[model samples]
Target: MSARRSARRDLRRLSGVALTSLWLTSLGLPAVFSAPVSAGAAGSWVGDAPSVRLYTPGREVVSQPFLPPGTPMSAEITSVSWRFTPPPGSARLETRLCHPQRCLWLATPRGQSRALAGLAATGPFVMRFRLPESARPSAPLRIEGLQLIVNYH
Candidate 1:
């Protein structure tokens, strides 16, 4: 009798899951157990650890220009964020994202992320950085990473 009761409990739980899945599917949503959609085609792109080193003070360091592979030209960039550790000092670091036509300055202090409203990813972007005179030339400034978050139709 106990064994039969346990089986019924298990069956009830399974049926509950199936019913939820069916309801979600009816609403044009993916089931909970379904495979996740791929973000490569249209989703956020995070580029990590470019790890650029800046030697000269006040001289601009430009990274090798790049973009998320398979990203279409028509894709619109909704926002962008940067992550890095600033060289230890009062020296302020300047950063920018540049394409062929223009550049957008990332003006957040302490390496915080910022948003770019409806900025189209027209082409590949290169990271440009410059340190103030207060920066110690003896110590190279390391830009840890950069992340580009994009959304598209």
Candidate 2:
């Protein structure tokens, strides 16, 4: 009778451990395999007849552009800015843009400049460009060249 009782207790403990492990596995694996979801909807605007594409953390790419010439052309991204809050307990905001010739790195800085090297694939990416102070909204900026390749991981 004591042997039977010991076996029953061991089975109960094993069942409890198995259920706990299963629950943990279900909760942990989705976060590991899936992409981080964004908190709010992404937005876009066009300047100088250029195109804008925004990729949210939920793996949705929103493409918006004002094709002035009625033909598809590369949009000059003068500025890109956004606020991101990453998931808890892990580093987030790894985004980048790459072209055939080079890549550019975007950072949260207060200035206007061009990126010398290819874009880095990490962090809170913010970019600013030097546009003429007198530039008007109606004035069409020539953006017939270049393409923007965006990525986030």
Candidate 3:
């Protein structure tokens, strides 16, 4: 009877792992357990879009129609820079990037107690980073945008 119970427990554990892998694969994310995650030692840029692709070395591109809120975006970003021009009189803008195991967030009008308003026509909002080595084509990550408002403004 003890042997039978042990076998049953092992079967249940295996079933759970199989189910998790299937779900991730269905979503197009790399198998989380298949390998160790690492960032690329050599800098590289991977563009984030409906179909993510690696960009040419040292080339930079800006996205149009800044991202909307609650979406996750991922890119194999390299050492580079980018500029953003929010609409005039618009509130603050928020941006974020993430990988399977990590996330980074940035907000505009940084460090000032006063709320940011009336954005200029253009400004430096560069994102520079090396792509994660373990990155595999996952469900196309998304960049989410949020507009912040200040009572004083």
Candidate 4:
């Protein structure tokens, strides 16, 4: 009882704002959550978790298996600002965001091009990028600045 009181007091002092609400779970645990008073830009979606760099390969003459899988599909994406950087000798790349049987490829104009079209159903999905058999990277590839606008339903 006193601990919950102390927690509430601490949060109040820390937030420096009016107390919204406090929730106590069946397990007798008090949790604090906050909501932004002002909304972000129109048509924006931030995932509960950030997108992560899948893998960074080292220099060697062997094939890396592939990316395992990503978080289950939670929302539909509307627009994307995505970029992938491959090292020297890396070209003729084919990238895909795939379901087990069906897949969607990244539509990029820089190298070869394929456009991403349609929605990916919610389920397990893996991203696979293939380099031409004759091509190899001397350094690891870096995925940078990926921002997605999502359709939340």
Candidate 1 residue-wise lDDT, 19-52, digit = tens: 9999999999998685655553455665443667
lDDT of 3 by residue, 1-153 (tens): 699999999999989989998999999986677554343322222222321222332222233322323211332222222233334443333433322233235444222222122222112122322223353323323322322211111
After aligning candidate 4 to the native by TM-score, how far in Å is the CA of 83 from where it should be?
4.3
Error of 1 at 32 (Å): 27
Clashing pairs in 4: 107-114
Candidate 3 stretches greater than 4 Å from native: 1-41, 46-84, 109-153
- Give the TM-score of each candidate: 0.57, 0.21, 0.23, 0.35
Error of 3 at 1 (Å): 66
Write candidate 4's Cα lDDT for 20-128 as tens digits.
2232454466556656534222232322212233233332222222221342343333333334444444455566544445555666613221233234323233445
User: Which stretches of model 4 miss by more than 4 angstroms?
Assistant: 1-89, 109-125, 146-149
**Which scores better on TM-score, 1 or 2?**
1
> What alpha-carbon RMSD in Å does predicted model 3 have with respect to the real structure?
19.8
How do the candidates rank by lDDT, highest first? 1, 4, 3, 2
- Which ten-residue region of model 3 has the weakest summed lDDT? 144-153
Comparing candidate 2 with candidate 3, which one achieves the higher TM-score?
3
Output the lDDT of residue 100, model 3. 27
lDDT (C-alpha, whole model) for all candidates: 0.66, 0.34, 0.35, 0.40
Of the candidates numbered 2 and 4, which has the greater lDDT value?
Answer: 4
